[model samples]
Target: MKIGIISDSHDNIDAIAKAVEILNNSNVDLTIHLGDIVSPFCFDWFKKLRSDFLGVFGNNDGEVLFLDKKSEGVLHKPPFEVEIDRKEFILMHEPFGIEKLKTQYDYVLYGHLHKVDIRKTDRGCIINPGELCGCLTKKRTMVILNTTDNQTQLITV
Candidate 1:
């Protein structure tokens, strides 16, 4: 299965739209938003996605209840875990929470710092899809992970 990962979108509708287009073109089985989605309006665009979507709340996310109500299918509370294709995946909005994990997962995903980072540890693969907002870094990016082989490709939007 292929999974699309995105984060730090900070309400850049155009960038989000572009990323969604790319993910759709790639035919990802699932899309995970690490956080900093910022606004409910921005998430509306995600409704157009063909793949399944899930997200965690970031520090910047406001109106939590409203966002949850509007994005019932997409939002997942932080530090959550799910098994897909027999691989366990953990999702969080901040990297710090990952350090406190007691169990190992096949993939650990988080977003906070607006930088693209991919690394492997004895435990599993760690990925941050970077800033989709392009506000601080001035570059928009995301990543697609091939779960079958645990390989990933970074894409700039």
Candidate 2:
């Protein structure tokens, strides 16, 4: 399955819109966001863009009540082990937790550093799609993970 992965939008509407359009056109089976949904604007943009957003809570995320209310029916993989297609996947917003989880999952995806990172080991892989909003990085970015073949592509937003 083709999965759209994005992180740390930081309230960039135009970039998010473009990314959403690209993902929708790609006909991805689903989309996973690494959070940093900032505020109401961010939440609204994601809600209007598509329905396949599976995300998590980031450190800078504000408006918890609002986000929670809007996240109903949204499949948010917690900061824990989440299984997809019988393959173990771990999603979180912080990276430090990875040291312990590296051995537990087939893949680990996270955000918060605003940098694109993809690494592998004898056991599994870890991926970060970077900041879609260009928060800390001047280059806006996102990632497309093709689960069918275990490959990932980075796109500049």
Candidate 3:
């Protein structure tokens, strides 16, 4: 199955809207977010549209419960795991957590730095979707992963 990944949105509604448009065009089975959705509006936008999403909390995610209140997606605090299409996927908001969780899942996804990159370790793949808000890095990005075959792709917005 095709899965879409996004993170560090930092509440840029326009950017998230663009990313959501891109994701919707990709024919993904679902979308998973790494965190920093930014504001209540951003969270509400996704909740009102899509029914499939998973997320985690980042250091800058102020008022966590507020975002969760409108989330149709899954949110993780630190280390969280889910099996999609029979493959185990782990998610976190920080890179350090990815390093620590390397050996525990088939894939480890994180976001903190507003830069998009992917690395393959002995245990699994670590990916950062970057900041879709395009604030710090002046670039927006997202990721797509194929749960069945371990294929990954990074998309810049």
Candidate 4:
């Protein structure tokens, strides 16, 4: 199964649209947003995704109720745990205690610093797909993970 990962979009509709196109074309089985979506209106782009999607709330996501509604209840508070393709995964908006969490799940994914971070551990991987908004790094990025082999491709969208 292929999983699409993105974070810190910061209301960049263009970038988000591009990322969604890429993910859709890539035929990802699931798409995970690491938050910082900023506003509910961004759903205009997110709704275009062709695969199943979910997300966690970032610090900047103030309209929690609307975000949840827009996401159709797929958006949740940070540090959410999910099992996909028989792999245990933890999703959070902030990279807090990731080292500790890594030991417990097959993947510890987070966003917040607006930087790309990918670390392979003995058990699994720790990944942050970076800022889709290109606000801090001046580069829009995302990730595609193959669950069968645990391989990841970092993509610039």
In TM-score terms, which candidate is top?
4
Worst ten-residue run, lDDT, model 2? 72-81
Best by lDDT: 4
TM-score of each: 0.93, 0.89, 0.89, 0.98
The candidates, ranked best first by lDDT, are 4, 1, 3, 2
- Kindly list the per-residue Cα lDDT of model 4 for residues 79-143, writing each as its tens digit: 89999999999999988998889889999999999999999987779999999999999999999
Predicted candidate 1 versus true structure: per-residue lDDT over 96-135, tens digit per residue: 6555552478788989999998987565688998999899
> How would you order the candidates by TM-score, starting with the best?
4, 1, 2, 3
**Lowest-lDDT window of 10 residues in candidate 1?**
95-104
TM-score of 4: 0.98
lDDT of 3 by residue, 111-143 (tens): 888888788777557788788888998888888
What stretches of model 1 exceed 4 Å from their correct place?
97-103
Q: Which segments of model 2 are wrong by more than 4 Å?
A: 48-51, 73-78
Better of 2 and 4 by TM-score: 4
Colliding residue pairs in candidate 1: none
Better-scoring candidate (lDDT), 1 or 3: 1
Q: Tell me the tens digit of each residue's lDDT in model 2 across 37-153.
A: 777556566665543667887877777667767766453535856776567888888886686777878889999899889877555568899889885778888888877677888
lDDT for each of the candidates? 0.87, 0.78, 0.78, 0.94
Clashing pairs in 2: none
